[model samples]
Target: MPLRSALAAVLVAIIWGLNFVVIDVGLEGMPPTLFLALRFAVVIVPAIFFVPRPKSRFRDVVLIGSFMSLGQFGLLYTALAIGMPAGLASLVLQAQVVLTVVFAALALRETPTRSQVIGVAIGALGLIVVGSGRGAETPALAFFVTIAAASSWAIGNVIARRIGRSGMTSTPLAGLSLTVWSALVVPLPMLALAFALHGSDAVGFALTHLTVPQLLSTGYTAWLASLVGYGIWNTLLARHPASAVVPFTMLVPPIGMTTAWLVLGEIPTIVELGGGVMLLLGVAITTGVLGSGRRRRLRS
Candidate 1:
């Protein structure tokens, strides 16, 4: 990947990493699905009307939204609400990086380079270390649900790459369009689930009692995290091979852990810290930031 795209991916990781803390704030005031529904609803409306649809088929847009937006966030928020710590959730959710690579190789025939494979392997080990050190305390159900969210996100990544490869998403607004339009499939279903699970009374109470912090959290998540973050992310996916793009997500866990420590008081264990360091090393390898420097040194 080019430096510009690589930097964009890093930016998305920072936004999304801090996003876990923000989600905690929003969930304090409302049910998970309700919060999720409102987030997507806000992503629509004025923006959707202004943004043209992606050039892909309407159903493909729906498919991307269902997995990427609805399935991913719904399960994730639910996991966080139920007891998955923000820091650990961030680390665990990176299961999607490996999942995306595997799905891309199988579905798109995009074989990863040897460095990517080695870097991903080391990153996977880091995930295991982090998970084993902290995940024992997490509720079993919440842990599994988060894994499900990762699977859904991985599938969405592959689909987005496929659409991008098809030459349909060539517009500058392609990412924004896909993000806005695909979100059309999220709100109603989430709202229905919210009513069913929480009852209309609880949902209504949460809506009326939305505090300023909660509203701010929702706005950050909707605009910055969902719209801008994902818009850039999807565009980058369209531009680069999945292997080149997905590993950058390894940065999110470290950023998420640091943010959680600062904001939520979730301190990391020694083991988790070590694992995070390994994760960074793995990302450096996979992204070839390390290798490129080595080559430059030899040439000079």
Candidate 2:
């Protein structure tokens, strides 16, 4: 990848990493549902008018929207709400890479190479180390939720790959997602359950107790991170080879950790630092950044 692509990767990582801190801020007085509502609103309005739509069908729009917006964010935010730490949430989500490879092998018939298996094993080891460091009694529960979130994300990735070909991919993806959460998904049953389970106190507190900073944080998460951040990243994806570009995602967790430290004053644990390095190294190897066969094949 060019230095420009590397820098773009870093920019996306920084914006995303700060999102965990932003979510913490936004959740102060904002219900996750309402916050998500406001988020997509920003994308659909003034901005959507400016960006052109892709050539894909409404069904395709719904497909990617469900995976990318609904599935990915729903599980992720719920996991965070359920006591998953922000930086750790960022780190644990690395399970998506593993899920993606496995899904591709099964569904798309992509054969796994030796390099991928080695990368995944190292990545799994990093996940184990991170889990051990988490002070939770039921580390297994946290891990299960984290992995579920990753699997949902992987599903979204596959959908997005299809949508990205259309010129209007990002806008529709963002628009459809916000619409799903706000209009379809956030019906009375959802709120009724939220109220029943957490009580009006928790839900009520989130709404009335929100601040200006919190609102902006939520806006950033929905608009900038989802809309602009993913928009640019997907545009890059449309131009670059998947093997060349996708590897940059491993950099996101580290970026998120640094952002959490700087913004939230949460220093990374020693384990997080090591795990982050291992994860990135694993990604690098998986992407063929360390390829010897390429050189040999070139010579041949």
Candidate 3:
């Protein structure tokens, strides 16, 4: 990848890492599902009018929206609301990195390089370490729910890659358009879920009484994270192999954990911190940054 592309990916990681803390803090005194509905609603209006629809099949757009935005964020917000720490939630979500590689290979026949395979194995080990350390402090239900969110995200990544690789999204705006258009799939179902969980009256109360912090959080998530971050990300997915792009997400946990600690006071346990280090190492190996130089020397 070019340095600019690499930096862009890292920028997305930082934005996303900060997003967890924002969600955790902002969701206070609010309903998770309802907040999600409002976030997507913000993503849709006005901007959707200017952005043309992605040329990919409508079903592809729907599938991407369903898995990536709806399923992933729906479950993730719920997990955080129930008990998952923002820092650990960020750490655990990196499971999508490994899952994305596996799903890409299975669904897209985008074979993983040997380093990718090894890196995935190491990354999986890191997940196991993190999982083992989730004691009474982290709710078991929340941990598993976040894993489900990761699975949804992985499926979405594959779908986005398929659309990108299909040569359908040829315009500079296709990725952003795909993001905006697909987000249309989120609100109604989330509103329904919110109503189911909290009753219509409660949902109405939360929406009407939104706090400034919550509104700020929604703007950050919708515009910066969903729009700008994913706009760059989907574009990158179109240009590079999924394996090459996805591993950069491993960089997210450090930023996520650090910000969560500083902002939310969610310090990780020793074991969880160790697991995060292992995850970074795995990402290094998976991205070929760790071993490529030695391989080049041997080749010479």
Tell me, what's the RMSD of every candidate? 2.2, 4.3, 1.6
C-alpha TM-scores of all predictions: 0.91, 0.79, 0.95
Q: Candidate 3: how large is its RMSD?
A: 1.6
For candidate 2, report its TM-score: 0.79
- Candidate 1 C-alpha lDDT tens digits along 46-124: 7988999889999889999999999999899999999888887897788787667767778888777898688778867
lDDT of 3 by residue, 9-77 (tens): 999999998999999988999989999999999999978999998889999999999999999999999
lDDT of 2 at 44: 61
Each model's C-alpha lDDT? 0.86, 0.64, 0.89
After superposing candidate 2 on the true structure, give the runs of residues whose Cα lies further than 4 Å from its correct spot.
1-6, 137-140, 164-209, 292-300
Q: Candidate 1, residue 260: CA error in Å? A: 1.0
Ordered list by TM-score, greatest first? 3, 1, 2
Model 3 stretches astray by more than 4 angstroms: 296-300
Choose 1 or 3, whichever is better by lDDT.
3
Best by TM-score: 3
Order the numbered candidates by lDDT, best leading.
3, 1, 2
